[model samples]
Target: MRKSHAFLLYLALSGLCFCGLLAHGLFKKQADVEHLEAKCRLARTLQLTDMCLFTEASYTRHLSQADLHTAFQDYPMSLDHFPSGAIVPPPEIVRRTNGKVD
Candidate 1:
């Protein structure tokens, strides 16, 4: 019942809980594969784009589809209006092209 022992016990329990969650998710994902595949097929048929990551600004919501300037729509020196803009880096295409559209 010492402080160190108590902290060690808490860490052990947290590790066990983390492993249990990972195992559960692995099995659950296996069971849901068919359903997920069906959803993906439907999306393909509907010509859906990549899944939305952030729901703040349009640029943050769909980074892949957003133009580089969308983040600076207000002005050239305008700060990002959405926190997600700071969190998510510009898309690979924008980075590769250096913000130049093809």
Candidate 2:
């Protein structure tokens, strides 16, 4: 009836909706895990490499194949030209080996 009570009710409903969406995603993904695993296995069987994440730059296209200096090619402190550079981090192998592929 009151403004404060209405606001509280709205907050409660929104929170419930958020929780419901999260639960739906969790369950749906769990159900799809088997299908995803099968696809992964098929990809491995075909020797398929990782999917391209960003089409802007060669380094951004396939992170695993990118060398360390490609990102800083312009200069040491040069800002990234591709927006995806900020979004996708260097792969773990690149970080562990400091960009040495072997």
Candidate 2 per-residue lDDT, tens place, 17-97, comes to 999999999999999999999989988998866685588888878777877687687999998888988888887666878
TM-score of 1: 0.69
Estimate, for each residue in 79-101, the C-alpha lDDT of model 1 and write its tens digit.
88888888888888778787465
TM-score, one value per model: 0.69, 0.62
* Candidate 2 error regions (>4 Å): 72-102
Off by over 4 Å in 1: 1-19, 99-102
**Model 2 poorest ten-residue lDDT run:** 93-102
- Cα distance off (Å), candidate 2, residue 90: 4.6
Whole-model alpha-carbon lDDT for candidate 1: 0.85
For TM-score, the strongest prediction is 1
